[model samples]
Structure formats: C-alpha cells, structure tokens
Target: MSSHRRVWYPYVSPFDPCPPIKAKAYSTPPSLFLGYQPPNLEQFTPMEALKIGTLWKVFYDPWYSPYEVSTEEDQS
Candidate 1:
C-alpha cells in the first residue's frame, strides 16, 4: 500500500490538458548588440544582408565628421 494519496485525472488523448501559454511582450525595442546577426532577415534575405557584416553602415559625412579621430586609438 502506497503512503501517498494521488488524485489521477482520467487520461484524455490527443488534446493537451496543460495550462494555456501566453505570448511574450517586448518591454523594450530590439537593439543591435555587438556581433549580433539578424537571424530573421537571414530566412528572408541572406545574400543582400551579407554585404554588411557586424560593421555599422555610414552613408555620408563620416570622414569629415567631428567624431573622426586620426590616431589609431583615442582615450578621450
């Protein structure tokens, strides 16, 4: 005789009796983390996206911009 009393529900086949699952909501907008490759775009457009890798794209004025540093490294 088992010491534990177990309440067993009748076996229901096919349909799942588990609790309903809720979809996750995004609290914040997605950001491009370091070394992040957009996985979703891969399924749709792979070849086109590959032209630009982890590097950020600069359309214009990057060379003459104030942020540009001539030195190899800038601590400032």
Candidate 2:
C-alpha cells in the first residue's frame, strides 16, 4: 500500500541565525485517493468512531505530528 506521508528537505539559508531543520514531513488524506464513495463501506465501532472523529474506516486519516508532548493529564 502507498503511504500518505511525505517528507522533503527545506532550503536552509546560511545567513539565518537559527538552526535549520534538515527534513519536514506531512500527510495527505486517504479519501484523496478515492474517486468516489462506494456502497456499503466498512465502519468503525460506535465508541471508536467518536474517538477517531469518523464513522467509516475508509475515510479515516489520522494526523501525523513529529512533536507530540504528553502532559500529566495524558499520563493518567
């Protein structure tokens, strides 16, 4: 299967004072690959749908972040 995630190297200026990020990443939604919605698409469970913010599994495209900081609330 093809991945929705993509990576690229950004142009870093020598004159810039801050350190340059060698690579950056981003993702595209899975829905983009589909031409149209088909009949009887698979679905997630009721609780899973609420948590994932989508009912249909085919339409679910999770956000990918390089920096994810966990707080005390998340640990609990």
Candidate 3:
C-alpha cells in the first residue's frame, strides 16, 4: 500500500476573472557612515600654528601677510 495520497484542485475556465494583487511600501535606512564632511582649508595654517606653537616660527614669512591687499600704486 502507498502511504502518499493524491490531491485534486478545481480547474478554472479561460473566462474566469483574475485576482487582485496587493502592493507593499518599503524604506531605506540613512547612510551615516558613508556621508562625508569637507575640511575647511582656510583654517588649516592657523590651526597648525596653535598645535605646533613656537615651532611654526621657523616657517613664518614676514613679507607674505595674507591680510594685506595690494593697491594699484603698490602693484606699480
């Protein structure tokens, strides 16, 4: 005797209507690890001077002040 039993399902005609399908909503998590923040290059030399202290004295240039602007007379 066979232990397995056969099952039968009803067959639908070609004229039968199709069943409706349900849609699902999905969301993605924020990428905190992959996000990047740019560095402030303008503050680089000042920050370095603070950290390095007196050692920055050797690299200082008295003639090259970034705050001073050259006028037309100065350029001439």
Candidate 4:
C-alpha cells in the first residue's frame, strides 16, 4: 500500500529524503540504497552537527529511537 506523508509530494515515485526532512519509506527505489555514498562528515561544522542533532532529538521520540540507533529518519 502507498502512504501519504504530505498532501503534495513534489518528487514522483523514486525520491528519498526530500531535503531538510528526509523520511525514508518502503517505496524508496532500490537504486537509492545501491552503494550510495553517505554525506561527508569532514565538511560538517560542529555547530551544524549540533543543530542537526538537536533537531533529530526533537523529531524522534525517545521510545522509538533507542539510544543505540543512528540518527537516520526511518519514516517507513
């Protein structure tokens, strides 16, 4: 079954993480997971990371986000 997170999804079928908020879905195309190079950690400034971390902390619920899980938005 298809899911609708937003009323108007900009990208057609095969898009993932549409920008500031990247919510992964099962419908995501296989190509996305095929050897995708993760963003470079070296370029991230401390402040940038801190901001993202704080946003992620609030975005996810503590119960769902176990202390061990990495901060990837598992929308699916």
Per TM-score, the best of the predicted structures is 2
What is the Å distance of residue 67 in model 3 from its true position?
Answer: 78
Instruction: Provide the lowest-lDDT 10-residue window in model 2.
Output: 67-76
Q: What would the per-residue lDDT of candidate 2 be over residues 3-51, giving only the tens digit for each residue?
A: 6777999999999899999999887888899879999999999999999
lDDT of 3 by residue, 1-76 (tens): 1111123345656666875233322222222222553444223366677775422333332232234542422655
Better of 1 and 4 by TM-score: 4
Instruction: For model 4, state the Cα shift of residue 15 in Å.
Output: 34
Q: Model 4, 1-76: lDDT tens per residue?
A: 2221223234444555444323432233323333553453234455865755532222322222223443334543
All candidates in order of TM-score, best leading: 2, 4, 3, 1
Candidate 4 ranges with C-alpha deviation above 4 Å: 1-35, 38-42, 54-76
TM-score against truth, every candidate:
0.16, 0.74, 0.17, 0.19
User: Cα RMSD to native, each candidate?
Assistant: 23.0, 6.3, 29.6, 15.9
Alpha-carbon deviation at 6 in model 2, angstroms: 0.6
Who is ahead in TM-score, 2 or 3?
A: 2
Give me candidate 1's TM-score against the actual structure.
0.16
Better of 3 and 4 by lDDT: 3
The order of the candidates by lDDT, greatest first, is: 2, 3, 4, 1
Shift of residue 59 alpha carbon in model 3, Å: 96
Residue pair clashes in candidate 1: none
